[model samples]
Structures are given as C-alpha cells and as structure tokens.
Target: MKFLFLITFIHILPQCSGNPLSRHHTTSEEIKREIARYSDIAKAIINLAVYGNAQNRSYERLARFVDTIGPRLSGSKNLEMAIKYIFNALQEDGLENVHLEPVKVPHWERGVESAMMLAPRSYNISILGLGSSVATPPEGITAEVLVVTSFDELHKRAQDAKGKIVVYNQPYISYEETVKYRLLGAVEAGKVGAVASLIRSVTSFSINSPHTGLQKYQFDVPKIPTACISVEDAEMMARVASRGTKIVVTLKMGAKTYPDATSFNTVAEIVGSKYPEQVVLVSGHLDSWDVGQGAMDDGGGAFISWEALSLIKELGLRPKRTLRLVLWTAEEQGGVGAQQYYQLHKVNISNYDIVMESDEGTFTPMGLAFTGSDKARAILKEIMQLLQPINVTNIYENGGGTDIDFWVRDGVPGASLYDDISKYFWFHHSQGDTMTVQDPSQMNLCAAVWTVISYVIADMEERLPR
Candidate 1:
C-alpha cells in the first residue's frame, strides 16, 4: 500500500507541475494524493520515533543532564558544560557538521536574596530576585509597601508611591497580558518614586514557590532592585494593605552582573542529499534560569530537537535539504545567542527554508503555530493534516519563537510547536521546572511530531515560499 501510494504521488507530480522546482503544480486531486502519501510517510516516521531510542533517551538523558549539570544559566560553567556535552553527544550520534559557534553572553549571579514582612505578623516571604537585578544597599532597605493591582492604579497613586516598595499584585489573566508587570515592574515603580519593586509571579497557578526571570530597567529611569514573590504572599500582603494595615517589608538581594562570558551555540546537521545549501533550521535554547533544573523549560526543547536529528540519522533517512540543529544559548537573557547567530548568518538568510523552535514546553502534540506567507501557510496546513491521527492537526498563523523572531521578521518561513502547555507558566522559571513535571510519553510524542514535520519540510519538492 505504501509503495503504491508513493508511485501514485510520483506519477501525479510531473503531470501537475511538470518540474519539481516549481510549486503549485498539482491539481486538487493530485494535492490530495500527495498529502496522503506524505501522511503515510509521516506515520512511518512517527512509529519509528515512538518505538525508537528517542522515547527513552529524550527524557532519561534530560534527567541525567539536570541531575548532573543542574541549571544552565548563561555565562555559567554549567551552560558551557552543557554546550560541550551536547556537541560531543551529537558527534557521537553520527550527526554531520557538528560544531560550536561562539557567543558572548551576560553573567548574572543570584546571590543571597531575601524578603521579609515586618508588619501584620512577621513572615518570611518566598522570593527569587529577578535576573540582572542590582543588589540593595548592604543593610537592605526597609520601607512601607504600596500594593497596587494594575499599572493604572500605580499611576493614580503616584504620590503615595513615594518612599514605598511598590508591590504589583496584578492578577494573572494570561501570560502575555500579565507578564508586562514582571518585565516592567521595576521601571514603573522607579518612575513613581518607589524605592523598590516586587511583582507577583506571572502565572495563573502557583504554589508557595516564587518564580524568577529576566527583567529590564529602562536607562532613562532610576534603577531599582526587583524580585518576584509567590502568588499567595502577594495576595496576602495585598489583603493586609486593603484593610488599612501598614505593610512594611525589608528586601535584600546580592544579585550582581559580571563581565560578559563566552558561550557557544551547538550546531549539528544532516547534510541534504540534494540541496545541501538550502537549510531547514530546528532549535531550542540551552541556557535557562538559575532557580531549578531547566528540564521542562528547555531541556526538553533542546533534546527533542536533537532527537529529531538523531532519529533521522539512525533511520538512515536523508532529506533533500539540509536539516540544521542549533542549540541556542543566552535565550533567557533576551535571545542574545540567537541575535548573535542572526547577525553572523544574516547574509545567508534567504537560503533558510524554514526555522522552527520548541521553546514552549514539549507537552502533548497539538500541531504548530507558524508565521509565513499565505501560500506557505496553506502548504503547512495541508502538511499538518498528516498529523490528525494523533490529534495534532490544528495550525494557526503568526506563530514563531523569540530566538527565531529575527528570521521571521526577515521573511523567512518560521514555525514553533504548539502544545497543551496549560501548566507551563506555572512552573516556568521556578524550582518546579524539574523533571518531576515531564512525562516520558509526552516527550516521545513531541519528538515524533518534530521529527516528522522537519523531515517532511526538508524533503519536500520545493522550498516553502517566503
């Protein structure tokens, strides 16, 4: 049946397009037949991935990486070691053209940090200093707390913000909506004459754990120390202030930034059997927050991308176009590694056929969110139909990853895996991001989908239209 399907697809190819170089050659029936052929191949790849070493190694290797190496913060020794490990692993896996590309990354260390409530009964508040935050004075600053739910409320009470520690208890509506507080909490509070700022973790659900991530300080505004507190603590303090209770807290952080550290973007490839110069890029960031093991955040992402290449190599399947796997570094620090990579390779951007990232947690497969021209989207939508057997057929437009944003902006076809990440933000940047949250079966399925999609794209008759 598979042979017959391929024969039919091949026979219809020239009749519709006359040449493989030109796209849009197939009639509706030919397109349907081609899609069916691709679907059958995709199922074969999926089966190979599911029963192959990726299912076990993707998770087990990540467990070892997290347990052995711990967090992979940019400019840290751990991240460098991670690059080395992955580079060596890829070479050992028989992936061709494996090497490390240098990137200078920021080094921010989270030293002794603490926050305490002195009023309304003493409580040791759980807090994680935001990455890159400046340390408070040696003695720490003790100030009255000003609680506000929104930036508008802060603007309204600007006068009261003077000499106070602004605490943003912004309720979590969605990650995209609520994350503004986390990113700009310090700048907004500094603008309002606040001594410091603390934002509730940007997650709809949280335990007593405090999540930490990168925060920005506008150069024109006063720099202030900032940290994230657990949702329970933020709400509790908000309640205290609502009852006219004086909320006073002491915050001390030892976070300090050091000189830029040298890092690398790990690269490996399966050279194309035909168009070796035309590249299909698949990637995930290697650097993660300092808090927990970066298992779910991106260990799954990086490894699954590697697994895609590994499965392809082990299966002796070579695409018509090169499949390049990039393990990006310093992504948590505003996509610094990917930025450098883009700068170094922008001249060849046109040769890039597609760039796919999996920074989002690799949960159950749910197709992809893509950003491309309408024609490209149509082709991808049809390709994704092959994945309906696993219920991952849904495809949406305007989807890409932070690392690949530059490529997408340059009009290169870009995509990222879409998964049911309902609990992703909850554990992101927190100690809860360890392997405890990862499911092996889910990781296997994610690897299967990634491998099939990237392989099919690389082996397609023509590159996706820009």
Candidate 2:
C-alpha cells in the first residue's frame, strides 16, 4: 500500500510547477496549503506506530540486542558480532537492499587499570582510562599529586606540575565546557611535564561514577597516561591540596592501541516505489563504549531507526523515496564510520532528500531539531503539526546529531531528535548507561516521531529545499 500522502497530493501536485529535483517545486503559499493537506496521512502513520503493532516493540528489540551484544566497543569481537547479528536480523525482517559497507576502525583495548592514593590518608580512587591513551610504565608512575581547578591555574603553577600527577578538579559548567578537560587534559598537563593526569569526570550528576571517553594527544607533546576519576574523589583531593597536605598517588594502566581493524557500516533500506535514487536516511551508531550495556547511548537510537523501517513495512506503507538505515561503526571514535560513509556516498548527495540521527537517548518526545534553509524549515514546520496527537509538534532550528554533522554542514537538510534530556548526561558514557535507563513507552513515542517524520518527507510529492 502507498503512503496515504500520495492520495492527498494527487490534487496538490497540480500546484507544483516542475519535477521534485527542479528548482521550481512549489510556491510558498502553495506549499503551506499542500502541507496542511497531509494532516490525515500523518495521523494514519502516527496511529499505526503509537497504537498498532509497533508499540513497545522498539524497546523490546533494543533490550534483547544490548543484552545479547553488551557493549560494542570499536574493533572488538563483540562489535563484529553485533554487526553480523543485525545484518541477519534485517534480512529476516525482509527489508529490501540490506547490505554492509566496509570501513577500517581504531582497535584499542582498555586493559587492567587502577589508581591508588599512597598519602593523605591512603585510599583507592575509581578510574576509567580515556580512549587512545597510552599505558604507564610497567611499574607505573608514582609521583606527588598536584590538584588544580583549571588550565589557567595549572599554567600559573607550572613549576609544581613538573614530575607530578596533575589532577583537574575543574567544576562542571556544562558538558561542552567541562569535556575539554577530559578530551585534552593530558596534553595540557604534559606541557608542564606532569607524569600523569586525572580529570574529574565530565558530568553534572554522578554517584561517584567515572565516565570514560575518547581523549586527544598532540604529536609534538609528550604523551602521559590519563583517566577520569570520580567527582567525589577529585573534590576530596582538591581540599587536601588546599590544606597544604602532601598528596601522593600511583597510577597503572595497561591500555594499548593495536593497528586499525576492519569493521562495517551495517545497512538496510525500504526501496521507494517511485524515485528509488532519492533518499531519506536515518541512522545511529552501532558501536558504543566498553563499560555499559549501551542501551541508552545509541542502542536505543539504532533500534528506533530500525523500528522506523519495521513500522513502515508492517503498515504496508511504501514511500516515494528510498529510506535507508546505516548503523555506524566507530562513531564513538569521532564519527569515523560516518565520515567514511559520507565520502563513499557524497557523489549521490544530490539525491539525498534529508538525513536523520538519534544519538541522544530516546526519552520523552518533544520534536525535531533541524538544520537547513528557511524554506526547509517552513516545510518541516508544517509537517511537525501532524504529531499533535503525541504532543511532539515542536521544531527546533540548527540542531543535528554528531554522526550526521558532516552532511548538514554541507547544506543538506539534517535533523536530530530533541527531547527531554534532563537525566541524559547522568548515564552518558558510564556503567549507568544501561537498559534500566530506558522506558518502553518513551521509546515507542520516540520511534513514532522518527517514523512519522522520515516517511512523510520521503512520500511527499514536493522535495524539501536544500
């Protein structure tokens, strides 16, 4: 069965001057009325997802996927298993044009690691080594610990940083502001010759949990072992330093980076009945951090994308444009898989109608955050009204996902799910990121949002302005 929008657009098509790809698609006034006509079709799609066969299905599938596959760290055998598992599952679902594209991803292992405070009332400090960080010497580095609040303070105390273990207790301002200390804390400390560095985890809310993520190393600077310490511990050590109490610590890590490993960008699609070459892409990274179940970070996002295809197929609703799902590999390693995908598919960029990603946790539904031209926003704005039944009719501008940032930056219409994120960072990148953080009803609403928006855009007779 065709998307109901095709029937609604039959009379509306007379108002458009040219083909979908032509510059003269629809006049502003004509588009306004034409989009309003889609309300019924939109309601049908939304109803089929929120109240029909797809209810809670995405959440159940996500739980099983993450439970069976655990954390899918890049280049691990576990991630390979996840790719194959989904490759088979997509075929089983009968999605058309299912395939995998090869890409080389970083292979790094976080071996046995720990930290101990030998002075100032001896105790153990929880630590999770940052990605791409080098290991300490076999005996580990034992040095006087230096606690500073920020990079400015470290530079002012450069003399004290030498031959010491620098600990950054920088206050959590925001993830964007605080995360710099995690991503480049070692490089900054190395300038002053610190033997090692420990950054307070970059999170606003924590129960003494340490979050691990990718860190950067400069080529010309000395590389030192770095890890994230619990917020509680970082504060305690800072108070000890304020009292002029001697703080000493020993750090040991067996972190190693092997040569790049071959991985894949898992792919599946529902081919268009009309213009198959024109595409509306939906995606989330299949790869995740090694610590948690990855259910919240992207397991939810990836499954919701699959659910988009699943729901559409279940309803027997085929769009006019192909809907493609690319489960990215090594996205945690700085969008490596997505960047490669962009390169391989950019020649067909002209055919890309829009791209969507849901890296943010699938929580309560709000609306989409779009990045595109004013005309595109107008089209999206009208389409968002269809979600009134679910109360997710808002549309934020200039927001897109990390994995799809490249496509948006190059002038393609891009969107990221914008929802309630109050507790999102609480579990991000920690062992706290598990299926418990997910709610089935919330995922159903999220899947409905992704499906409604993707399918409506794909089936619309007029193309969105780029």
Provide TM-scores for the models: 0.94, 0.95
Over 261-295, each residue of candidate 2 has an lDDT whose tens digit, in order, gives: 99999999999989999899999999999999999
For each candidate, the alpha-carbon lDDT, in order, equals 0.86, 0.89
Model 2 pairs in collision = none
Output the number of the TM-score-best candidate: 2
**How does model 2 fare in lDDT?**
0.89
Distance (Å) between predicted and true CA of 202, model 2?
Answer: 0.7
